[model samples]
Structures are given as C-alpha cells and as structure tokens.
Target: MGFKNFRFQVVLRVALLVVSIFLFFRLDFKSQYVGTQLALGILIAVQTVWLIVFIERTTERLIKFLNTIKYDDFSENFSSRGEGKIFDELYQRYNEVIRKFRDVRSEKEATAQYFQSVVQHIGIGIITFKKSGEVQLINNAAKRLIQVPSLSRVDHLSAEAPELAKQLLALPAGQSTVIKLWQGKERIPVALYVVDLVLRGEDFRLASIQNIQRELEEKEMEAWQNLIRVLTHEIMNSVTPISSLAGSVAADVQDYLEAQPGEQIVLQREETEDMCMALQTIEKRSQGLVRFVHDFRSMASVPTPKKQLFEVQEMFRQLQMLFQEELLQANILFLIDCRPEGLKVLADRQLLEQVMINLIRNAIHALADQPNKTLQLDAFSDPDSRVVIQVSDNGTGIAEEAQEQIFLPFYTTKATGSGIGLSLSKQIVRAHKGTLTVSSELGKGTAFTLRF
Candidate 1:
C-alpha cells in the first residue's frame, strides 16, 4: 500500500481507540461494571478487526486498479461491493480518470496514424528536426528526395543525407529557398522550405522539399515560344516590304517593255536601260532578304555544343584582329588584358569564340559615335574560383528599362540592329554551362561579363 493509505489507516485507528476508551469509562460509571466492561471490550475488538480487514481490502483493491491502469487495461473496473461510502466514492473517481485517459490515448493514436499516412503518401518530401539541428523524422518522400539508403533513426543526417541537410540548413527559419543539389556533378533543382514548430515548450523545425525540374522546363518552353513569335514578327517585317517592292518593279518593267514600239528605238533603248537598273536594284534587295532569312534560320537552328578545352587568350586575339579595321575607322581604342599562360576553360571553343566575337562587335557599335571611344577586354580569375571575361566600353550605354530586354531575341535599340546577336550569344554561353550578364549606366558605359 502507498504511504498515504497507511497513514490514513493509522490515524483512523488512533481516533477509534480514543473514542472506545471514553465510551468504556462512561458506560462503567453509568451501569453495571463487569458485563458492561466485557461487552465494551468485545465491541472494541470486533470493530478493530473489521477496520483492519476493511483497510487491507481497500488498499489491495486500489493497488490492483492502479496496476490495471498502468497495463492499459481500462476495461477493468473497481468493484464497490461491500465497501463504505468513502471507498465507493474513491472507486467512482478512479474509473472516471481511467476512462478519460483511455479516450485521450485513442485520440492521440488516431492522429498519429493519420499524419503518418499523409507523410508517407504525399508526393513532396517532409522532414522534421529537433532544436539541436538533428533530424527527428523523415517521410518516405523525404527519403527518396535525399536518396537515403534506408529508413532508420534520422539523427545525424549530415552524414546520411548530406545534400538534403545542406539545403535545409541553408534555409532561414520561416522562409523558403531554392537550391540545386549536385548528384555526381549533375545539378538537380529542389525547392526547400523551413518553418519552426513548437511543442510542449520545445522548439523544432520542419522542412518541405519539392522538385522544380518540371516547372522550370515548362517555363523554358514558354520562353522559347515567345522567342519564336518575336522572330516571326521580325522576319515578316523585313520580307513584306522586299516582296511588295519587288512585285511592283517587276510589273512596271513588264508594262513598259510591252507598250514600247519599234518606231521610237532610241527612247525605248534608254527606257530599257533604266528599267534594267531598277530590276537590278530589286534583285539586290531580294538577295539581302534571302541572306537575312538564312541568318534567321541559322540562329533558330542552334546546334548542341561539342565541349572541349580551349585557350582564352588566343580566342581574344583572334577577335581583336577580326575587328581591328573597324576599331581604327571608328577612332576607337581597343585594349586586351590577356593572362600570360592563356586561361584554359572546358567549353565548346567554337561557341565561346562566337560569343566573344558578338560581344566585341556590339561594343564596337556602341562606341561608333563617341569621339574618344575606348573598349577594354579583361580576363581574370574570380575569388569564387571562376574564370571571368569582361568587355567594357566608354560609350552611350543602354537605358535601364531596355537593359532587361536586351538579351531577349530581336530586341534592340539601334535602328540597323538585327537584335539576334546578344540573344544568340547568351544561348551559346549557357550551352557551355556558363552565364552571360550585363551591366550598364546611361551616358557612362556598358559591361558584359562572362563567367565559367
């Protein structure tokens, strides 16, 4: 029996003993002494034995009831048979407590099972971590996301789930970040979200991860669709005028040749010569249209790159030689800062050369109107272990609003510009697994940076 039950029994026995003593004295003084004394002693002994038995039964029953509760046998009931009012009341209260506990346990189990099912079946990955940065739980989706070997204790995820752990840790609390995980040098984009969870006065974090490859692919398709639309619009604009002019010239030449007679031979000869010249001009414009179509087709049919290692300095030298005459004629100063050993990069040499050429040509055109035109080409290594090539010019720079669309296909500020150069250059750079970025300030200068 517990100490409280034992103490309660002891106090009851002491109070009963004091009452029996007082009753014995009062009865002896009021009535015949011997029989009264014997009757009172018998009564006292009977009551003491009964109280001892009652206390033992009650304590044993309470212990059994508590054991039933501990063993999760809530069906077991405390019998109130042959018990006093206090014992009956205590049994009633105990049953109520056990019933409430069982109800709560049932609810908890149901909730836990529901959550488990959701986590296991959901498409997105879900991971929960303790406040100490240790992974506490990971769903099946999460295991597949991180490529976990097996479902085990999630503690110390840094070793078992390095990629996922890195992404989760990089995310700020209550915010989401997109990260590209490298699986054997192949980048896989994943969107990660982290949020704090507080439970029972302890703090934790939950991370949800989703693959964004399909979304990005869809966006890329949409962008390509827009590019095609723009190309069609530009080609039609150029071809429509050429076709109309050519048709008109052909008809005029036919009518003049048919209406002329053999009598005015001299006048007919001069008219025939003028018509011939006009027809030649029309032929020249037609040829220009054909060349523009060819260029457009080439841009549209950009081929897959064949990657190889190439020297950067040699590429720059080749481009400089190609544009040397234009630089001289435009009164532009061209400067190149090439590395001594020629920085080597793993890329498509031909594509890289094309990108550099386009960038240089664009810079030259930008500097065409400047009296003191200056162009600088610099190649260097960045702190992030990337090789960077920069082309800068001191000319009228692009406007801020137009800068965003400059790399877009068929977007240009110059009247004579075809606008496919920068877009094609960017595509080429991206195919080489590099980036082409531009920065410009109006009236100051423009810089195009390529990083590999």
Candidate 2:
C-alpha cells in the first residue's frame, strides 16, 4: 500500500485500541486492562517506525526532483506510482511546468533562426555593437561596404575614414549621420542609422549602412542640368544679337555695292566705312562667343589624374614665373613660404600645377585694387601626414553669400569672370586623391587650402 494509506490504517487502529481501554476501565474490566494496554503500546511503536520510513522516502524523492531541475533536466517528469497522496498534485504541477518550458525553448530557437536568415540575406550592411562600442556581429554586406580585410577585424572605423568615422561616432542614440567614404578612386556615399536596442537589460547599438550612390548620382545630374540650362541661356543671348547684326551689315553692304557707279561717291564712301566698322564689331563679338565656348568645353572635359610622387615646391616656382607679369602689373607683393628643401606628395603634377595657377590668379585678381596688395603662397607638412598648401591674399575678401557658392561651376562673383576656374580646380584636386577646401570672411582675405 502507499505510504499515505498505511499511515491512515495505523491511526485507525490506535483509535480503536484507545476506545477499548476506556470501556474496560469504566465497566470494571481490570482483567482485560493489561492486555489492552500492551496491545495499544505495540501498535503505537509499529506506527511510529512506519511513519519515520515514509517521511524519509518522501524527503528523498523531493530532494531528487529538486536536483533534476537544478541540472536543467526539464524534460524529466515525476511518476505518481507509490508516492504519497499529498505529493500527487505537486508532481502534476511540476510536469506541467516542464512542458511549458519546452515549448518556450522551441519558440526561442525558431526566432533566433529567423533573424539569422534575415541578416544573411539582406542586401544592406548590418552591424551590431555592445554598449562600449565593441563590435558584436557583422554581416557579409557590412564587410563588403567597408571593404574589410580577410584577416583584419574592423574594431575601429575611425582609423580608415577619420572625418566620416568621427561624425558617425558622435551621433547620439537614435540619431544617424551620412558620410562620404573614399574607396580607392571612387567616392561611396553611405547613410548610417544608429538605433538603441535593449536585450536582457543590456543596451546595444544597431547600425544599418545604406549605399546612397544612386541618390548622389541623381543630385549630381541635376546640378549639371542646371548648369547646362544657364550656359544655353547665356550662349543664345550673346549669339542672337551678333548673328542679326552680321546679317544686317552684309545686306547693307551688298545693296551699296549694287548702287549706280557715280552716285554721291563721298557719301557712299563714308557710309561704306561705317558699315565696315559695324561688321568688324559683329566679328569681334562672334569671336568672343567662340572663345567662351572653347573655354567652357575645356573646363567640362577635365581628364582623370595620373598620380605620381613629386615635389610641390617646384610646381609653385613654375607658377610664380608664369604669373610674374600679372603680379608686376598689379604691383602685388608675392611671397612664397614653402619648405626650403622640398615637400613631396603623391599627386598628378599637371593637375596640381593647374590648381595652383588658378588659386594664384584669383589671389592676384583679389589684390588688384588693394592699396597694399600682398599674395602669400605657403606650403608645409601637417602633423596628420598630409601636405598642406595655402594661398591667401590681403584684398577685398569674398562676401558672405558668395563664399558658399564659390566652388560651384559657373558661379563667379567677379563681373568679368567665367566662374569655372575654381570648380575645375576642385575637380582636379579631388581626382588626385586630395581635397581642395576654401574658407573666407567678408573684409578678411580668402584662403584656399589643398590637402594631399
């Protein structure tokens, strides 16, 4: 019998014996008193031993079940056979808990698998980082985006693209930044979205990288389209009047030539001279138009740079010679503060020289009207492993509104300027794996710095 049933039977026997003793004592039954007392004592001893054994077995089973749970054996279920009635309900509850846990574990595994699949298949780059910014996970797309080396880990992106990396790292939680990264010869524009995520009470950042090449291309096309429209308008304005004037002059000359032989020779000669002058004016205007078209086309057809190691000081000396006459005419003081020896850099010599010429010419122009005009061309090496060349002029500084658009194509502030020089120079510098940046303030001279 089960322990609970055996305990119950023992209790019933004790009760019966106690009642028999009571009856014997009350009805002068002393003769049976000794026997009844002895029987009750024996029954009490046997029941005590049985109760101790049952308690020991029950405690042992409970300890075993608890140990099973501690070892993560949630699949094991306690059997009800031979167990006390008190433990039957407890066993059933424990089994139910194990079943629920199994279901939950299965669901969790499925969820993890789904996320893994998504991360692997997605085209965009995905990276996860811990709160301390240590990389936790990166997908194939992320590797491709950064051009990660096979043997190297991307623990610090700042080392690769310092300016862009700093901007990204400074972004607050739930914020994002877009940066342009140079991969070899191409500029890849990427948008980074930083998101804060909490997992098991710990915080993390999930960075999603999206390639914005198409968007950048669209914006570039739009800019070129606008430039084209402006150029077209300007060309038509200058060409139409010249064409009409030339046609009118030709017809007038033809009519005069066909007039009667001796009709007012002096007056006809005077008229002929005036017509010839008018025709020359038309020719000059047309020639100017042709020159403008040539210059514009030349600016548009800038060639890709073929980079080589060269001395920057040599380039500067050549520029100084080329613009010596202009400098003398303007009475401008030209100063060169380049290294006494040489500053070496990897760049396209021809393109670099073009950029320098454009900058120096602009500086000369700026100082043309200044009372004490000075143009300084300086070159030095920066601590960041870059060669910096600065062109500064003490002249009428750029206006605030025009400074921003100074580098844009066909955006000249000068009344008699073509406006494509600075833009083309910037393009050339960029093509040589360098940066051409400008900073200026009204009433303060402008400075253009080339970093290589």
Candidate 3:
C-alpha cells in the first residue's frame, strides 16, 4: 500500500492490470465447471476495476486542486493521507501554496480599496483614459467639472464644447492646457494637466482638471483694488494743493481789486501777474490729470461682452476700409489674410475690433518713419481648434524689460502714452475667454497674438 515515489505507484498499478488480464485469459481456457468459471471471472472483473480506480485517483485529485486555484477557493484544504509517501508530500505542498495565494490576494484587495477611496475623495477632477478615448476611471470631481453624471469617453464632451473635446483628446502628456466652459451665463476656466502611464501593460493617460476661474478673478480684483488705492492717493495729493492754490490766488486777486482809492494796491502788478501765471499752470496740470483719470475710468469700466458669431473675413474687410487711407498716407503696407476663407469666431464684435485697433495703432506708432514699414494681420484656427488672430509689424520692437509689464495699468514707455490701451485690450481678450500675448525682438518686429 505504501509507495516510495509517484512512478513506483504508477508502475505497480500497471503491473496489477497486466497480471489480471493474463489470468483472465488463462482461466477462460482451463475452467471446466460452470460455478468455478463464474467465480474466477467475477474475481478478475473486480481486480481490474480496482486497478482502474486506483490509477485514476491521483489524476482526479490534481484536477480538483487546479479547479480550486482557478476559482480562488481557499476554503478546501488538500489531504496528505490515504495515498503513498510521494502523494502525501505533494498534497502538503499544494495546501501551503494555496494558503500563500490567499494571503497575497487579500492584501492586494485591501491595498486597492484604500487607494480607490483616496482617489474618489480628492478635491480636483481626475480622469484616466486610453488613447482610443475609452474612459477607464472618472472621479466625482471630474463628473461635476464636466457637468455630467456619467462619462464613457472624452468625445462625449463634444456635445457641450467641440473645441474642448478636441483639445482633451489631443492633449499631450506632461503638458497643461486651459479651457473655458460655460455653465448657464457664467464662464469657468479649467486647467487640464495630463500624464502618461502604463497599467498592467496597457498605456493610459491620466488627467487632472481644476477650475481656476475664481482664483483668477480674485487675483484680478486684488490687483485692481491696489491700483485704485494708488490712484486715490495720487489724485488726493494733486487735487488738494491745486484747490488750495486756486483759492489763495483768487483771494489775493479779489483783495487787490477791492483796495481803497489812492491806497497802493497791497498786490503789485508783478505779483498779480505771477499769481495769474501760477493759476494757469495749475489749470493746465489739473486738466491733464483729469484726462488721466478719465482714461483709467474707461479702462476699469469695461462692459460685459455681448457675444455673437461673426466672420473674420468681414471684420478684416472693415479693418481694411477703416485703415486704408491712413496706411496709404503713411506709406505702410497693410495686409490681412484669413485662412480657410471665411473663418468665424464667437465674441463681441465691437470689443474685439477695439482690441485689434489698439494693437495696430501701437504698431503704427512703432513704425513711424522707420524704413520698410509693413503691418500684417492673420486670422486662422490652430491645431487645437482655437481661433488665433495675429498682428505683426516690422517696427521698433518692444524692449525685453518693457514687454513684461506691458499689460499692467499705467505702465508705459512712451511719454505721451496713456498706457491704458494695451492693458484694456488685454482685459477685453481675457473677458472674452481668450489670451493675448506678445513676442518681440529688438530692432526686428513685434507680434501680438489673440487666442480664443
């Protein structure tokens, strides 16, 4: 009953089968009585059946073990009894291996559940997807940011914003892009950052999206309030002295006029003239200050945009008509090109037109009397489906130091400039859910780009 190895067990079963068959044939030829032959045949049949069962028992146990492993069923333990020493050892190893697998699986599931909870509760929106646009995971924040209850793919965003969907699909890993989303009447700015990763041998992109509209507005308000404080301080300093001086000068002049007859006027003619000159100077400076305040007010009080779809070509045509005479007189070659024929953008026509005019006017000033004066305007859509409008001119380029603060209120390099034009234009573009940027090289040219 006890075998040293698995091969010895198999060989013993085969030998028993061969001996039973040989005896069965011999008994058939030698048996003479009916009862005897019947008994011998019954004995041979029982032995053959026992040998088949014994040989098949190991195979059956192996099949059961494999099934348990496939099903991750760890409740059943392998028995190391009733078989030979080799089978006892094999069953013991199987039991130990199954126990190890159970422990590993439990730990893995616990770890996975922990990370899942963390991912779900994070503040920022997160989504993971394959290159084919199949969404793998989406957190609650992502659903709220996207304004969707369930998302299966990135292209689903096309229903709300076509450009946004395109950008999301084509966004490169390790890069970030800002997109504008409109919820009712409010516009939200979402910043998206993507990273490439591989999970279980499959490539995926993980993106984190966060709304930055409120933050930007807060910072902008803070900047404006600071500027207002400075403006108030400067206006008070200038106005108080001007008012006091005006009042004093008027009092002196009135006293001189009311002097008694024959009494030498307390104010000499020279002193009276000096007072008059001082009043004139104050008046001039006050008027200049008034103009400055007016410009600032204009910049601060930009109205909310009334958006409408308009063709870029039509706008360009209007620009040509508006600037043709001036460009011709100044001997500046002005060119406008709208690629893809009649590209259009959704924005406030009047506001965008004002921005373009400000940029072109600045270019004209830079190009004044400069040789080979050329101004170019281009309108087209970028690869990410954003509408881009560029104004480039070969003029006295913006100095590197000045370019950084060009969009700040009251920052100007020109003595006669109000410094609000470029800043106002920048605010207008930002309000329209766009960006305005500038690139310039010394003595080469300056180019301004508006992307929406």
Q: Write the per-residue lDDT of candidate 2 for residues 1-452, one digit (tens) a residue.
A: 64346356557656665665565456454664678656656766666666567558767757766776677666687777544465677778777777777777789889989998899679788877776767778887777777664212234776776754565455687777787665532346798888888998988777788877556544653576467667856886879888888888878766765774565533467777888888889878878788777666655567888888887778778888998998888898888887745778888888788888888888888877779988988888864468888899888888767865787777898999988898788767766656776667666687888888
Tell me the TM-score of model 3.
0.57
For all predicted structures, in order, the TM-scores are 0.48, 0.50, 0.57
- The best candidate by lDDT is 3
lDDT of 1 by residue, 1-452 (tens): 43235446667776887788778877756555878777878878887887778668667877877787788887877766634567678889888888897898899999999989988889898888776676677888776666775544444456755666665666679888777654321245788899988988988888898877556644653586466657756876877776786787778766655777554534467767776776787788878767776666656666789987777788878888988898888888888896645787778888788888888888888888787899998888864467888899988998878875787766789898888888788777766666777778888889898878
- Give the TM-score (vs. native) of candidate 2: 0.50
Order the candidate numbers by lDDT, best to worst.
3, 1, 2
**Candidate 3 per-residue C-alpha lDDT over 45-160 given as tens digits, one digit per residue, 9 for 90 to 100:** 77777767866876887888888889988777888655666778889988988889889999999999998888888878899999888998999877777778888988988887
TM-score of structure candidate 1: 0.48
How many clashing residue pairs are found in candidate 2? 0
Error of 3 at 349 (Å): 2.2
